[model samples]
Target: MTADIAADILVIGAGIAGASLAAELAPHARVVLIEAEDMPGYHSTGRSAAFWHETLGGPLVQPLTRASYPVLEAGGFLKPRASLEVAEINGLPLLDKLASEFAGTGVGLARLDHDGIRQWVPRARPILVGGMLESTGADIDVAGLHGSVLAAFRRAGGMLETGRRIDRVERIDGVWHVQAGDWHTSAPIIVNAAGAWADGLAAMAGAKPLGIQPMRRTIAQVRVTTDDVPDHLPLVIDIAGSYYFRPEGPNRLWLCPHDETPVEAGDAAPEEIDVAIAIDRFETVTDWKVAAVERKWAGLRSFAPDRLPVYGFDPVVDGFFWFAGQGGIGIQTAPAAAMLGAALLLGQPMPDAVAAIDPAPYAPDRFVALAQR
Candidate 1:
């Protein structure tokens, strides 16, 4: 199985991040995308309950999400879908605080009273008194977007090698020698976009590990007794972050308990306890009796200490790039993030799509100062 391969840039992890970055850089450079799994997006990217919410990743990530909207919309990967954040009467103050946080961010939030809450979600309990609607929220076609990016990269002459579990990396002279099983490759630059396993990849490349921690989140599809479930129902969430649900079909709904449990990087599976907790929380939110659980799964969301994405070259490791720690914002921010990463990798000006935002906050050098201190 010994073979030799070479590329101008070698990217590890063929998830949304690697695929999108390859597509962005292919026209200008020879890129090779490597994935451990037989298929791309076998983990986080495939399991995402793909939705583009303006406020999902908080203030720090809003810019990248907003910057990516134009590309996502133009690709026909986004479908109109609003989001509703609900709170109990006593929780109105918290809802108000949330609304004020996004005031001038261009993420429009309209406050809703009791009647308004009922109008948005007929199944909402009477005790729910306050809500906020993010009209710009939309459903993302995750598979479509990932496939399209990979397709474009291939069409542009970017090479892809799946089932290549990279085990060793070494910098010899000015080039990188990467080995996965019996195969070998050499490139001038190595991009770590390994999702939950990003830290391990960095360590393999003799780069500083950014302390990326993968947290498990559970989602389930269940049949509810409520007959009013509509296909157009906005994504309903609790401002308290306890639970969220939206109609999936005639009588089925996609629900989650909003759980984030710290776990090791691996193939994640759903815990029955988490699924039961989700069902219990959903029952308390409304009168919808969960008739049965049809499906359940779990995925990991990796984060840096600051909860922001890491996207720059390692200050100490020459030719090594950091494109990890995106967390749940990875999917929504892929397009813009790739463009930004590509721009930085090539030492070119920031693309117009993300020119307003400074890249310093996400640079690997930020961690250098912190590590020194």
Candidate 2:
């Protein structure tokens, strides 16, 4: 109950990826998860929009959704929440392209005329909308899903050390000696899952830096007319992804601009300009005006240069593994991401289902390959 002191596999972050990997690896190995904050998921994972749309991720990451669906379905982490993306006059071409890509992923969508937009979100103005409605997207049980992984990890003999903000790491006798405050932990296998802080950790481990940048994304909540907006309304968005708003309660809606501004890793805060942009866009698309802001916050969504998640062990380091650069798909793809980690750590054959998709596109070495040019 005090501290793990050490583990065979040491995970450096306590967000979705780290937590899920810890849960998956705990049953087979001695696993210890370390969090800089007093609680897990204090950053991006805690501030997610909690959507589970398989068609939204990159081509390389689509298979992760396919692989993770079984666990999500079995774990009851998803519930159908009707959703649509509206393309305005300026967004028609992009909307068409997105719809084509979505269709390729086996996601059912309808090319909605202005009238169709009003049918879904009643407040939506028909005159300026032309978009596609992705009929199969769902809302996620974020807290439940994240909690389940933590619960499973603990139940499987994994150790969790919270507020153990790591200060230093050094290779002594080819073993990593990690220091958090005065306490020390040594592990042969160290997973770089510190989310926004991943690059810093990699630097400490003497690994080459990957151009991982943490971007601040903000969200705000506003009151909606109860009778006009149903509690089960689909998540409505701009076809260009400039803004999105979804039902939070019978009379409340959550909204955010798809803003991505680079920032240092820490507790992200919502900006007034970002909030104004979302409200302005919401008013432009729908007749509803955001007169009151109930709440507002922000989170860091880190991304690699290619915008794909970096997985697999570092080529130069013997025991260091990369599991960062998840961007915004961390929760939806956690199951497969953790399984991928497990396979690499155990030095076992990749699961046939996952291997069929080929993980090389997302490997850490891909960055190395790009730099050679």
Candidate 3:
């Protein structure tokens, strides 16, 4: 078929990362966003737990999450939903340490005694001795966010191609020639935002591999035989990372064992053992009986060796950008991350939203030094 397509900036994924960045840059550049899947966000973006909490992704990611809050708030994609971190007697000290560490970070976490913890999460078993509440946490509308971003990109004259899986990439006379299926695309700049397949995409572009590992996370929706399940239930997580759950709806709960099994990039599915583990853990956390496993699914969260998102152009490959390794926090940090990525790609100053964040920690050059050692 050999259809020739050209763009000033060719983004190699249509997930949240690619869509957000394309939306940010489409107004200024000729952008083309391509997806291997039949539709955008068929992986992690669609399978996300769909919560936006300031402290969910750790201290390094908090800044990006905070920067993105305004956009999400303005877009009406955020709905108020608090998060509770419950701890057993042995885990109480860890909760205190976490509260102390985040003291002045603007992610206020209030220490909750046993009574307060129960008040927040009434269904929690008596094993919980203490807890902390992130009052600013909220549920994010993932689909809405992704759709809005892609719609804006298209409105700004960006081209979107689905079912085009890039198999070959080569730089020819200052232009990147990318071949996907029967279609061909050429651009001066190529953005690698292929999520779990990021390293593979970079390798295809002749860029250094960043050792991005895709880890599988499982989640299941179970109907609980309990009268306490409420639509307003806060997201309850164990301080020790054992399990987490929140009300999917009245009499229903969404739960995960907080598993991070290392795996390759592809369409992820929930393992039966993992599902059983999640249910088993949930039983220990709450007295609610699981009536049935309504549904279960799994998704991949890719991380760099340092477990931080990588952004900026490849230090060794000209016009090739690194915008992967966002892990589980990509959706919450999309607005700020995309802004920063587009700014760097365009050789512009950092946007005010993420100006305070230092880009050095996420630069691809960090791996270059590591690889040399």
Candidate 4:
């Protein structure tokens, strides 16, 4: 084979990160997006409980989330849905620390008493002492957003190769030669946006693995046999990160035990124990009775040792770039993250949306720098 296909850059993984970055880079460069699954976002992006909230991604990540909101909202990928982190009387201290931590971050966190909690998440048990309300949160249309970005990539003449998992990656002279299910391609540069398989891809590209660990998270959708799962309910999360539940429909809610069980990278599936645990946690916070489990799922969220996204070229490998370790906030932070990635990769000035963000913190070289110290 002549390795007939060629592009300026080859992006591995067609999830939100790859699709978004490919879309951003395509107009400026010929890009090839390769996916292991038959469809883009068959993993994390599609399995996301899909919510965009300023406070969800931590302080370092908040900037990306803040910058992405405007783009998602303007694109109509966001729908109004607030978030609440509630605590029992014993856990009130956690909420206190949370309020003080986000004091001037521009994330509007309102202190809510029991009555206030009930006002938002109606029919709540009195055991809940207080909560913090981030009223600006919204539901993200993950599929719509991913599709739009992929469509934009196609419109920019980017080639998308699905059902082809990269099996071989080797750098010859100044080019990267990749083989995925018999489809051979070459590019001057290769971007590792492989999500759960990011570390494995890095190793294959002759770049140092950045300790990207894939952890499993489970979600279960259940129909409530109460006065209806209130459509007005906010995205309810426990202050201590034990559980979270959000209204999926008028009579159903999606619940999670907030589990982060570490596991190998592969096709993740919901454990029966996790589904039972989710329902158990749901009952403690509300009076709603779960009539049945309509559905359940699990997805892998990969993260770096420091738990921030890695975006930049490899320090040791000349032609390898990393755009992984986004954790659960990848979809929520896609727009800004992609803009930042494109600017860094293309050696162009940062766009106005993320110009103020200091990208050094999320760079791959941070690990190399850490070793020196």
How many residue pairs clash per model?
0, 1, 0, 0
Which digits, one per residue and each the tens of the lDDT, describe model 3 over residues 1-373? Answer: 2339889999988999999999999999999998999999998899998789888777888899999999999999999999999999999889978887787897878888888987877767888889999889999999999999999999999999999988899898889999987789899999999999999999998998999999999999999877678777899989999899988877998989999999989999999999999999889877888999999999999999998899999998999998999998999999999999999899999988899988888899998888799
> What TM-score would every model get versus the actual structure?
0.97, 0.95, 0.97, 0.98
Weakest lDDT window of 10 consecutive positions for candidate 4: 223-232
Question: What is the C-alpha lDDT profile of model 1 across 65-123, one tens digit per residue?
Answer: 99999999999999999999999877788888887788888889999987887777877
TM-score of 1: 0.97
Off by over 4 Å in 1: 1-3
lDDT of 2 by residue, 1-373 (tens): 1233767889999999999999989988888898999989999898998787766665678889778878888998989887787887888997878766656666677888888777788777764568677777788888889999999999999989899999888877767788888778888889999999999999999998798999999999988544467766788877677888898776778889999999998899999999999888888878876658899999999999999999889989778999999998999899898888788778877776566667788899987778899
- After superposition, the stretches of candidate 2 with alpha carbons farther than 4 Å from their true spots are 1-4, 352-355
Give the per-residue Cα lDDT of candidate 2 at 152. Answer: 97
TM-score comparison, 2 vs 4, better candidate = 4
Candidate numbers sorted by lDDT from highest down: 4, 3, 1, 2
Position 160, candidate 1: lDDT: 96
Off by over 4 Å in 4: none
